[model samples]
Target: MLRIKKLDIFVLKSFLLLFCGTFFICLFIFMMQFLWRYVDELVGKGLDMNVLAQFFFYSGLTLIPISLPLAILLAALMTFGNFGERYELLSMKAAGIPLLRIMASVVIFSIFLGGMSFFFQNVIGPKAQKQLWTLLVSMKQKSPEVDIPEGVFYSDIEGYNIYVKKKDKDTGMLKDVLIYNFSDGFENAHIVWAEEGKLELTADKQHLYLHLYNGEQFENLKSQSVISQNVPYRRETFKEKHTLIKFDSEFNMVDGSFLDRRSDIKNMREISVAIDSLIAYGDSVGRAMHAETMQLTYKPAQLSSSDSIKLQKEHITVVNVDSVYNSMTSAEKLKTVTATKNRLSSLASDWNMKSYITQNTDSDIRSHQSDWHKKITLSLACVIFFFIGAPLGAIIRKGGLGMPVVISIIIFLIYYIVDSGATRIAKSGGMNIILGTWMSTIVLAPLGAFFTYKSNKDSAVFNADMYIMFFRKLFGIRISRHMFKKEVIIHNPTYKEDWEVLEDICNSCEQYARTHRLLGLPNYIQIFTNNKHDDVIKDINQKMENTIEDLSNTKDHIILNYMNNYPFLSTTAHKSLFDNRWLNLLVGIVIPAGLLVYLHIWRYRIRLDKDLKTIIKTSRDIQEQIKNQHLY
Candidate 1:
């Protein structure tokens, strides 16, 4: 039932080589982007080789989800593009092998790759995500390497500011060093002026030892008491003195247990459990807030048992608060107003606090929900990108890194923008989380389908001629004939026969112009209701092209010149708005749309009338030259 054909193996091998190379390339690019985001944290901190290695390893693992999709896109585009470019695709199709069958192996391989991507994300990605974030947080908290500038005051240390005026790099000696020792609060800060000093880290690397030569120390004994504000100060001179500054220089790995609570660092099961718990918690909070709000509106406990029974029997009351307020004294009114204001403020504060709590809870639930869908969306991205790239590659028929690379970037960029924007909107509660997460895939699925359909049908999806014709019809763009004389004529034109075809085309154009009422306005009703190609125009254009093909080899310079004057005519551009009668009818009923279409057609109609005259004029010129016997 299972067989590995040579064609399947060949396809697999070609794609496998390309995918492997492109995967690493994409991985490196994304890793560099990730690194740049945290470059500020990594730079200046004195981290060890293995620590950096761990960072690199964890980062690469975390980036695989993003990288895999891009790699697949680029690889698929290149693989099929290369095949199409080299005419291998044509050869296969020529052999009666359908495009889908040719692509069957790569599609299956892509699905397998998608599975691998899913497994990697669901298993290894979470651990790597946690470790990488933990490392980044640790690096951000790490102290910078101690490299004091000669003229700047280095204040990176906890409490002391050390200004170095000059330093000897070779012998590790400082000429003028001023140290502001503010370790004992700034109010009681002391100053140390040293003529020359030598600084070194202790063996434990936990303290900076400063050995100074001929230095003076000034200290002010500041006091809180007013009487002691005239403080007593002391100055001492020493030939040799040593001071110890507490500075921990050793790298310490931080505790990353905090990061384990994050959504990104959790597997599918963990995320699911977390999401359920979060949703339950959010619902409980919502119910609590609802109860709190309800308490303000109804308070049954405020009534006595008998009063409650009476109120239950008759839940109706009428009060005139304005009359009561008017009957109160000014003092009583002021006291009452103050009490109500205070009560309202207290309630507002409580409500605001509760609202904040509710918002935070909802945001947390959305985060877990976002991550849950992310795993599936990212896995699906691999398959989605493959479908897009393979079909697009075949349609574009461009190989190598140049065109494929550019196209991949454009497509990937569009996907990234849409996906990121949708995710942000979803996370902010602006859209449904599932739809937002799968936004890119949904938007591109149709494109992939379209390309696949076209490639299968052997359609030129990117054919420039089709688009050119469309715009020309839309804008009434003129077409010109640029006929050049050939030096060597293999088959000279039969002037007499060419004159007959040209003369017939001229007469047909004239007859059709008169019958079609080219000088009058179009019939608006029939223009929309009836759609037909001017057969006379089609016949004339065809004959003109055929005669020109033969006449292009003419030795007569004048006849060659006359052939270039014949305008390339159109059959349907000036006809009913489109071939679809229903669309034409819809536009015709819509007065403004119909009027615009009518105006464009009228312009083309006039142009056609002039073109028909030009054809007659040019044809007559060529006929006169032929009759004169200019060539044999």
Candidate 2:
């Protein structure tokens, strides 16, 4: 049997779980449209198997791109969440492994997936969509659910006024129902009522049944007086109620060609771009959240009401470009030179207004492009999410399904909202193509980075401690290790001084031991410390926990170093680290990759020199760190 480390197993399992979860979720949603939109056509028109299968297959492909990013976003968050919930993230961090390293691997994997998504969107999605529409158009009838609501009266299905009451929990039996069958025999048709009936399942589960216990029948003849008859009905059960729905209930088959025409390349291109723009908008919004959070931290003071009001007023006003033509009177407009000048001025003014709008409400630009933006936006979202996810998972320092699902859902909803909003705006023709496509990514990428940063710094975003506490309460079992030193000291005070001293020593010892990859004080010494040792060690453990907390604060870097080297400062400080070239290469790669991305996005000419210099400095810093480590 092959043996694998727990970490590897966890990563693999998490990916698989996320992948499957996303796939099924997307697939289910895709399938649902058939019931809601097309089932009636198939059943009523008696469409062939090829047409029906083709409809589903192509429809599924058309949805793949839209579904890919959500799937990845959800899956990654879930995978990491599961890891975090299990405290696997904690274990890795405690071992002095950087969360960034773990994220690097996951991100690399995500990029690959992103590429796959893009391929699907470009190659498979468009053609499939055409086929799907063609198949749907060819069908003469729609599915039953399209026209029938369970427990409601409907007159749309064929020539019957049907009502469904109670239904069998498992078998889908309609307990009480009525049907007025009037196919061309409008005035003479009989009305039948049933106490119970069941919907028959075909390849497509969209059929209805009626079983009446007791009811009266009624009929009206066009040429004669109306007739009514009393009838006693029992479980004269209407079994196998297989009824096909017509697809052409609302739409004519002759007109279906126009719909198919509407799904041509031009339409698809528009749809694709719209999706892309929406995805971009989602990322941009995420980035804005990240930026706002950082700004809030850096500048915590509240804005004055006057300033807030001024900003609000500006937000509501639209750019005025029509004024350019106002200067030309009717007589002046007649001159060729004046007319040309006016046209040029108007064009320039329009451009200026667009530029102003872009700068002032960049996020809004994503909303204004067109339907084409969404497809492109959604496709690109897959890539943007990879960057956010890898770092986020690493930061959370916990690996588990539950946390990942929650976090992923939160991130996804945010992305979805912004993306959807952008799409709406685009559809309304209020923004441009580029802005709409990239807005969400631009917004959310930084947010993902900010969260990643927090996670890396050991922020409590994942709330691992809360989970531990909850688990303890749930199982009615307490782990002494989780108890704080102050609590333990208050409970057992006999050797408080010794315990406190030991705690300081242990904190230092743990830090040095981790850095040097060495054992702490000998086992014999630990054993000798005994019951008295437990109290001392417990206190020491508490102090170490405090140190861990302190490490998360950027301001506490000096304190962290001092505390870490306390007990074994002389020995651990002198230990040597491995001079691995692979590590150096990784460092080299991260600097350029991160800087290039940042620079490309912030493409202001004034900042080009400064940005380039910063990139160079970052590269140098990595080299310096590697050199310093070697010297030590």
Candidate 3:
């Protein structure tokens, strides 16, 4: 028996709640998208409520695989984001709990979801897809409800148009009706006009009967061959007339067997079997086509007994095509040329038609194979997205739908675009079906791993300040003043002693600025190759910090303010640009900046000169303030 820990339960409860909400939302969104795609087929069909319900039900089921991965991604992001936002994750880490341990419950749940998604894809998805498409086809084929409005010609019926000047709703009667029937052919169309008429459906609801009180029918008897001749037609006037029109009013379900052979309607096993059969059939057809082409292009000459005997007698004669043509009479030449032309044309047409059929078959095989791989790829996406989302959420330290929603959408869009492109390429046989189908997964799996690793170490992956400093260093941008916290001193004045130390520091800075080549190309290379200036910068920083600490003991606020103006030099200012050796190497290799490197070095040299000047001036200012004030 396994016992669930409190932490696991807490994490699981949070994640499961978000997952359920997001899953249904995603499912509804995708279903709406699917519905919009087939809106034309669904609308105005007067479909039964039960039929619509079944369609939406099946559509929702079919879209489960598509929505599952996105839901897991969003839920995991929100869950971990909430933890990070509220400092719960920090507390956990402080209490000796690792990120991986905290994520154990959610990861298990995501794995279970992935398995469920796979089961749905393999079992429910295919059946739902089949039923949904079948219903759509049936709806498209179903006749529109007879809704003829007055004063407009209604052509909803197969081969007829009806117009009514006025209609009586209560009695279902039409006055001044006109009808055009072209079922025989447009050229032999018949037109009828009635003073009054009534329409009714047949007992079986498969036909319509229209009874006219007084009407005249005109029939056209025009022939295609007699286009220039006078047309003949007949007209008949009747007091009472009845016409029967074939119209199926009942909602009949299409046979599922009609779409049973489609790839979308098959399970993984069926798809695999069908793919194998198709590939085998394609191979056999290719061999047959190759044989036929070879037979046509490389025909062997017949050898009779007489020709064989003649070949053994004296000299062998080689026949040339030009000579053979020249030997024929004019009439024979014409006949031969015409026959050859006809034969070539027939062969070309047959080859084109057969090639087209073979291509269609091959495309079908690729589509089936792609779908088979798609089921697995979509299931795997859930796990991949979970890793990506959870780690990213923890790294960004953002909760709710604000930042996480934006990031999730961006990531999901990238995945969607890549997946769509790969699927298109695979469908067109531009790449291997398996490789193309799994391309998005292949691309994103490493990203998820990288994020997880970075988040586990509590790395500031999205720290704007760090990246800004890096860019500033790269571009050789330096500001005169640095942002620092201000402090007030309340002890008795030690300005005299501190002022002396400040002057000595100023003197050293001035001497160092003149003698040291601290910011040129040579210094840059030396810093990375060997830390030649490390001790000097470290010593200076230590002295600055020590002096600031001693100054904090002074009582004069004026002296303390002046002393605070002297900025402490950073040790990293003269060190290598990046702390990571690998990153430095990568930058050096990728950006072989000859001129840019020199420019950056020149800029840093100027900045260092300015910083030294500023430090010297600040120290002198403090000394001047201490001299003007009377010592207590």
Cα error of candidate 1 at position 85, Å: 2.3
TM-score of each: 0.91, 0.41, 0.86
- Highest-scoring model, TM-score: 1
Q: What is the per-residue lDDT of model 2 for residues 295-412, given as tens digits with 9 covering 90 to 100?
A: 8569944558995687588894543436534676777556846767897898688657655544544443333333344555566677677656655665564455555567777878
Q: Which window of 10 residues has the lowest lDDT sum in candidate 2? A: 568-577
TM-score attained by model 3: 0.86
Report RMSD (Å) for each prediction in the order shown: 3.7, 24.2, 4.1
Error of 1 at 458 (Å): 1.9
Regions more than 4 Å wrong, model 1: 222-230, 300-319, 323-334, 484-517, 529-553, 578-583, 630-632
Weakest 10 consecutive residues, lDDT, candidate 3?
477-486
- Tell me the tens digit of each residue's lDDT in model 3 across 186-280: 87889999999998889998999989988899987665433647677889999999989999977777887888768888889999899999989
Q: Which residue ranges in model 3 land beyond 4 Å of their true spot?
A: 149-152, 163-177, 194-203, 211-216, 221-228, 236-242, 301-314, 326-334, 478-493, 516-531, 534-592, 630-632
As a whole number from 0 to 100, the lDDT of residue 165 in candidate 2 is: 66
Clashing pairs in 3: 491-555
lDDT of 3: 0.83
Local lDDT at 108 for model 2: 61
Comparing 1 and 3 on TM-score, the stronger one? 1
Sort order, TM-score high to low: 1, 3, 2
In model 2, where do residues sit more than 4 Å from their true spots?
Answer: 1-14, 37-51, 94-96, 140-372, 390-401, 462-632
